[model samples]
Target: MRRLGPSDYRDMPWKNGGGVTRELLKLPHPSEPARFLARLSIASVAASGPFSVFPGIERTLLVLEGAGMALTLGGAPEVVLDRRSPPFVFPGEAETSCRLLEGPVRDFNLMVDRALVEASLEVVHLAPGGTRTVPGTGSVLLHGVEGRASLSGTPLAGEETLWLEAPGPLVLRSDEGARVIVIHLTRRESSSSGT
Candidate 1:
């Protein structure tokens, strides 16, 4: 497992050029083909606008800070989202737009090519010394939201992320009031039904 902090994150323009996002992690590092194969980021949205479309990607968005916003996804009914809400999942190709409910907001985003990966996200709260273990045979990301934690004795403070590849043993220790988002990623098994 590798502990990555804010200092490690990179700033880049949003896909639509409407704003910017701080990239948290990307599978296979940078400059790889199918860059969106599995990626995570935090985006700051200050204004309402259309979302950039990625034809083959699927994503989930979770409100991380501020009052949140209302999302009009494709032709679906408007939905209000905030930090307390569960992560919203949808196709990256959907015609999505957001209108801030109050002021600027921050969000956690996870994207992956549906053909290559199966991913899951969960938010959990922990107390001092509390430990969480991730199983092997896939990748998992522990994204800190509030308070502090440690991964295999390595400290991960607020807003930091821990990226782990296939391994047998892993543990995350948490402090009081520590809140985190765990993302589990696994390669999709080959199938014959498609043919």
Candidate 2:
């Protein structure tokens, strides 16, 4: 497994230009458009605001630092999320806005093309001993949310990520306790048949 660390994250302006977001990885790279399947990034929200819209995409956000956020999505009731809360999933096309709970907050985001990819995010409380195997199709992303860990023996520091394509039973182990974000992506839409 390969590792992407803090230094590898790309600093880019948000789609709405409200602030900047650090893009950790994009499946088709930063230059491609139509072929984008999955993307992972981190953004800091210093104030309450609206989120950038991305039609045909599904998004999940996990509070990595600070108090948390209260989100109003698609005319539904406002949902409050904190560091201990599970990741929130919503449609990218939905009208979404956020109200910070306390001060600024740092969050990790995962986006997948709704038409081509089905995605889910889960948090694992890892102990010092034992291995955690993540079974997935299409791709699996391991993010070290808190503390340090490893994927297939490759060291992943806090906030670092390891991307595995069509991964089988992947193993993760850590010497110290860790909090991990496991993103499972499966292909939902297919392309042309090989004829």
Candidate 3:
């Protein structure tokens, strides 16, 4: 198991050089975005415009700060997302753009090669004293979005995150109001584990 502290994250330019992204964690430590199998990052979106598309890749975006923005996705209705909103996106869809609803907002982004993985993401808001299982085999990233929380018997403060690498079952609980974002990464084929 591995833990990614805030200081461990590194910043880099977007694939299209439109903005900047802080990479929190990634597999095989890709030097470039196209070479990555799975990645977790964050960015501060202050300008309104379109985002570069990544074919055969799945992505999720979580607003972390500010009033958030509105999105118009291809074949989907307009949606508004703020700090409390869930992730929303259509990986390969075209015509997706953002219009700031309020002001600049910080966001958490996760992307994975569709051919390499089938992942799931969920946000669990646990009130003081509750437990949730963190599975083994697959990858898991826990982010404390609000209040204080404890995971795998360790405490996690707000803005703190923990990344586990194929670790065994784990537990997350809290003694105060806490919002935890959980990311699950499952390999598409067991034979490709070495990749």
Q: Write the per-residue lDDT of candidate 1 for residues 1-195, one digit (tens) a residue.
A: 688888989999876666689999887512346555788999998788888887778899999999999999888999999989999988998889998999989999999877778889888777876888756558878898999877677777888898878866667787665888888888777522331
Colliding pairs, model 3 = none
Q: What TM-score against the true fold does each predicted structure earn?
A: 0.88, 0.89, 0.84
Which candidate order results from sorting by lDDT in descending order?
A: 1, 2, 3
1-195 per-residue lDDT for model 2 (tens digits) = 567888888998876655568999988623346757789998988778899888878999998889998999878899999998988989998989999999899998999877767889998888887578878567788888877887777787787888888767777788887888998887754532311
Q: Can you give the lDDT of residue 181 in candidate 3?
A: 85
Model 2 vs. true fold: TM? 0.89
Candidate 3 to native Cα RMSD, angstroms: 3.0
Model 2 misplaced regions, further than 4 Å: 15-17, 29-35, 192-195
Query: 1-195 in candidate 3: lDDT tens per residue?
Result: 566667888988766555678888877523344467887888878777777776777888888888988888776787889977878746844667888888788888888877777878788888788777877668878877788888777888776778777888888898877888899888778427645
lDDT scores in order: 0.83, 0.83, 0.78
Global Cα RMSD, each model: 3.0, 2.6, 3.0
User: What are the runs in model 3 whose C-alpha is more than 4 Å off?
Assistant: 13-19, 29-34, 190-195
Instruction: Supply the TM-score for candidate 3.
Output: 0.84
